[model samples]
Target: MEHRITLNAIAHIRSSFPEKFGIPRQGGLADTRGNIVFEPEYRDVQAFRGLEEYSHIWLVWEFSETLGRQWSPTVRPPRLGGNIRKGVFATRSPFRPNPIGLSCVRLEKVELDTPEGPVLHVLGADLLDGTPILDIKPYLPHVDSHPEAAGGFADRVKEYGLEVDFPRELGAEVTEEERRIICQLLAQDPRPSYQQDPARVYGMRYADLEVKFTVNHETVHVVKIIRSMPD
Candidate 1:
């Protein structure tokens, strides 16, 4: 076996999700948008030549926020109500031997000429803002599509969409676009699967705005929206 291996980030993701707390567990769960800005060294237009032809692309990225942390072989997946432990290999838990993640996002567009060089606009991404990307590969439908694939225990976990109600006064703070994205995130039920306390108010940060909401039965009520103070 090779003694060691190394990887470098070719680009970084700019997304609305400024923090991890409210991000969807997997890509495509929410209609979140993001952009991939290539690093100065990899800014050549040739690097992304013909990339626009593909509708989706696979992103190989580092869990930078969780790097250098110890990992366990068994992990309690939030999908399992955060109670049942399963082998790390059988789950998509971020805490693993290698702090890496793979996600396939819809490529909305690719701009070759920009003040910052080549950029790829994508949709339905679950990545946090400023995530370092190790590599990007076009998704091949013939090879990547598995129509009959079973998701094991994951398939057994039923998905539940929540109703989002943002009062006009509080919702007016954000633009129409931000309001839509906020509703989309809350519809996917951002609260932990194990947490069912209706009285508990959850706060999620997105693009410098703090969204405060509470879950009452199957509905998520937006309580307030506050602009974050400059650091």
Candidate 2:
């Protein structure tokens, strides 16, 4: 006996990330800032009725970058310090029998326009730019949120607060709103758990400012923030 599954792309995400390496490991971890451009054929405004009532939506997408001719049954999860291997089904690793990815993102707004027809303004998406979106479903909090959910081997991961120090030169350039977003992102401690080097500088673009930091074990301390000068 044989079985088959066919999926179609309904939309594509437009984001700042063109590469996968730096994409957030999980959705809702990064600043909410991405757009979903629906295929022109599916752009009927009537299709989006009452969607605004939901704060979040679930994106079922293909792991386009990880798909291969064969798949391994076991995968190394970054959460496990990249040392232990886990069964593919037991983890959310992209290298699976089916390279499907799930992300729950905040729905900022929706627009019906001429270019892409209908576009969904979403925040906190971890997907790369031009990622194929297979389906969209409203998040049902009652069914999705679990207070007692177990995290397996990842339970021991440490949470650290970011220590941000703004340089005087750059400090004067940032707007209040930009600073708030940077603080929010830093509070989450964006560095990988396996990374412990204190000398390495990591930077990410937040609005007009370039934030750089170093991780000393579980603690993330800000090193520098340079605001790009206006052209």
Over 4 Å off, model 1: 229-231
User: Which lDDT values do the candidates have, in the order given?
Assistant: 0.91, 0.78
- Whole-structure CA lDDT of model 1: 0.91
Question: Per-residue lDDT tens digits of candidate 1, residues 153-199?
Answer: 98898686889999999877998988988898888887778999999
For each candidate, what TM-score against the reference?
0.94, 0.82
Q: Quote the positional error of residue 6 for candidate 1 in Å.
A: 0.5
Residues 1-231 of candidate 2 have per-residue lDDT tens digits of: 779988889899987565554466678876748899888777888988888899999999999988675778987777667787889888898888888999999999988765778889998898888899999999999999998999876666654455655555655667666665566666666665577678999887654557787766545566777767889
Model 2 TM-score, all chains together: 0.82
Candidate 1 weakest ten by summed lDDT: 184-193
Q: Which stretches of candidate 2 lie over 4 Å from their true place?
A: 172-178, 203-211, 217-231
